[model samples]
Target: MKAIFDDRQWHHDPKHFMANGKVLPSPEQPERITRLRHGAEAAGCDFIAPKDAGLGPIAALHSPEYVTFLKNIYTRWQRIEGAGEEVIPNIHPANRSDNYPKSAVGQAGFHQADTACPIGKGTWEAAYWSAQSAVTGADLLADGARAGYALCRPPGHHAYGDLAGGFCFLNNAGIAAERLRASGLRAAILDVDVHHGNGTQGIFYDRDDVLTVSIHADPARFYPFFWGHGNERGAGRGIGYNLNLPLARGTGDDAYLKVLDTALERVAAFGADVVVVALGLDAYVGDPFKGLAITTPGFGRIGAAIAGLGLPTLFVQEGGYLCDELGENLTAALTGFEGA
Candidate 1:
């Protein structure tokens, strides 16, 4: 398998990932890139540097105004008087904030839903290339590769069209799915992140061409509380195309796989020509998030299960913090996929 990656994503180096009033350095520390690269290399996967595919495909997945907002957020921060640091939000609108502020501070509040995803000098490039990696992976899958991995950082599952939350700027899976659809490969995104892929679900919620399915922690107690419930199916032509399977906190391997099996069944029924996996190893037992207790061995089972479908696959790396088993788990998952 080939692995597409960018070194710049590691430059995001966030200060913290907070939970329940506790502040701690992100568990998937900046060192994550090293571990991911190590895993791919050890797996004997060919690696390649990413090339810009331009903004046309990304624009198909994102709103142009929102894309402009993210690209310029850092530069805009420099122009504001009090914006002495990377952008973070202290204020947010109840619904949608209009009469948007000219200040980068106001834009920060307007765009970022959570404290995660602060903009730094490297963020825009990191975000851009991350999405580019996934989009390229999709292109590779379209070309009939059995499977490929995009080891993306500054994960994209949590980003919305107009907002950046949960350490994501662009929705990589969403962008890739758009590219696959544009290339006339009937595509669907199966997001297996521990946290709900709210941004991806939202982006395709109104279109029939892209079906989004997510299996993650239930929103009632998860990081993103606004969406991810079962009730919010698709709207318009997209109705009945979206699916959310929210496992409860403390869910285990068997439980997780059961949900995945259900998701795969739907994907097959949908007749998707290519499957994009929003793979997140954070569900491993030792993950700092600690909502789910899947083991390192379990990831292999998950990967194999998806591979069993035999569809051309694009694996978009989402969230897997720095755990001791980073390499072991990734290697095992790839092995399982091969076995399948």
Candidate 2:
């Protein structure tokens, strides 16, 4: 399999993350690229730097205003007399439908979904390349590749069309699915991240062409505390196109595979020509989030199960933070898919 990546993705080194009301160093570190690259290599993936597909592919799913904010907000925040180094929102509107604000601070609040995604000087460049990597991987699939992997940093399952959250700036998986759809392929995104893909879900929630399914730790008491319930069966024309299978905390491999079987059935029923695996290894037993307890071998099984769908697949990196087994788990998943 071919893996898409860019060195610029390492430039967005975030400094702050607010968890449980206490600020700490961010877990979405540059070291992640090193570990993931080594893992992909171990899995026999040939590396290729992504071509600059430019902003058109990214704009396909993200809002224009939000994209502008992400690109210029860091500099605008620096112009403030007493602003912090990173652009983290301290205030937010009562609802997203409220009026837009002109002040840099107000725009930060309006565009940023939470404090997890901080805009630093290098954020825009890194995010742009991360998104381009996904686009490149999708292109490879469209051009007749059996499988491809996008090692996206600042993982992007939690972002929305206009709101950034959960350390995601732009939705890489969503962008990849959109790229495939534009090529006349029926795309189905299967997000196996430990957290719900609220951003990807929101992007295609009202459309029927692309199917979105996410299996994650239940949001009832997890990180994304909203929108991962079983009842969110898409809206309007997308009524039956969306599916969310939330698992209980600490659930392990067997249970996860059982749920994955159901998700694959739904994808097959959709008659999708391609599948985008929003791959997140954070569900590992030793991961910092401690959401689900999927062991290293469990990831291989998960990968093989997804491969059972017998459709072209693209694995776009999402979560999976720093851990000793991070790379090994990635290798296991990809090798399992290839071996299958």
Candidate 3:
């Protein structure tokens, strides 16, 4: 596996995200990339830096209105006197009817889906390039690499076509699948992030051309609590293309793998030619934020199972925070894939 990364990008910075009603230290820190970097190196894997491919591919999966909103909003908000900080919505949409503010300040309320993502002046540039990392990984798969990893921060699964949430500006996995779809190959996204891939699911929910599957902690008792239920299969032509396997809190390795294997079987029956794994390591037993008890050694089996698909794969990094065993966990997964 070739790992793609950018050293300068991190969503955990105080300026990058706001959580718990305050500017907490970044959980999506630079060390997340550093850990993966070290893991790939220790596993004797290839590592690559991303090459810019512009926004055409991203525009395929997201709304033009939303993209324009993200790219230009920070600059517009900066012009506001005393609005020098990163833009965050104090009043959410639920606070009012759907008809909210239309200005950049008000638009911020409309575009931002949650408080976790706060955009500073340089946010668009970072997110764009971070997504470019995923695009590059997809391009690598299309160009005939068996599998590659895109360690992008400002994780993208929580980001929908036009709204930002969970420290994500662009849906990296969705964007990568779009790139593959443009190349005439049907793609499937398997999001194993602890949190539901609300954004990726929304992007592909109405289309039959791409399949999106997610396995996460049950939304009834987790973040992004409104979505990720089993009943949200799909709509219109996409009726059965979307699948959600919401596990209970404290779901462990054996049970998690059993559920995931069932999900993987459905994905195989879908006849997808390529696969995108939204690989988030936050489900680890040692993860500070969640109760999921996925052990360190279990990641090897997880990676092996994804590899078992035998399709071209692009592993897009999602939500794994700073932790002592982060690198070790990833190493186990990649090593398992290699050996498998």
Candidate 4:
């Protein structure tokens, strides 16, 4: 497999993360790239740097104004008289139905869905490059690669078309699916990340062309509390297109794979030409977040099952914190896919 990556992705180094009523060092750090790179190389993946795709690919999934906001938000936040080092929203609209705000503070709240995604000095450049990595992977898949991996940092499944959240500024999975669809292929995104892929789900919720499905921790007591319920089948033309399979907290491998069997069946029924796996290793048992209990070997089973679908696959990196076996977990999945 060819693994696409960009060194610029390390530029957005987040410092603080608000959790458990206290601000502490964030789990999303630059070291993640080092670990992920080691895993890709160990998995026998050929590393390739992404080219400058410009804003066209990303703009296709994100609004122009929202993209503009991300590019310039850090500079605008720095100019504030008493602004913090990073842009963290202090207030959010009771509902997003209101008009957009003019002030940088209000814009922060408007564009940012939570405090987890703080915009630092190099956030724009890093996020832009991270997105390009995913786009490049899609380009490789479209050009006839059996499979491709995008080592995207500041993982993107949590980002909405216009909102940044959960350390994700740009939705890489959504961008990859969109690019694949533009290449005349029916694309389906199967997000196996521990958290619901709310951003990817929201982007394709109304479109039947790019089918979106997520299997994650039950949202009733999870990070993305708003969406990811099983009943959120797509609406309008997209009805029955979106699928959410939320599992209970502490669910382990055997049970997880059983659910995955059902998810793959849905993909097969959809007749998707290609698949994008929103790969997240945070579901590991030792993960600091403690959301699920998927073992390292379990990831191999997950990968093999996805490969069984026999579709050209794009593995886009999502959330996985600093763990002792982080590299091994990632490599295990890719190895499983290759072996299968």
TM-score of each: 0.95, 0.99, 0.94, 0.99
Give the clashing residue pairs of candidate 4, or none. none
User: lDDT of each structure?
Assistant: 0.84, 0.94, 0.84, 0.93
Query: Model 1 residue 242 lDDT?
Result: 96
- Candidate 1 clash pair list: 28-321, 28-322
203-242: candidate 3 lDDT, tens digit per residue = 8899999999999989897888999999999999999999
How much RMSD separates candidate 1 from the native structure? Answer: 1.6
> Candidate 4 lDDT (Cα, whole model)?
0.93
Query: Which regions of candidate 2 are displaced past 4 Å?
Result: none
Best by lDDT: 2
How many residue-pair clashes does candidate 2 contain?
0
| Candidate 1: C-alpha lDDT | 0.84
Model 1 per-residue lDDT tens digits across residues 43-89 = 76789977789998778767787788888887877877866467778
- In the predicted model 2, the residue pairs found to clash are none
As for TM-score, the candidate ahead, 3 or 4, is 4
Runs of candidate 1 exceeding 4 Å displacement:
none
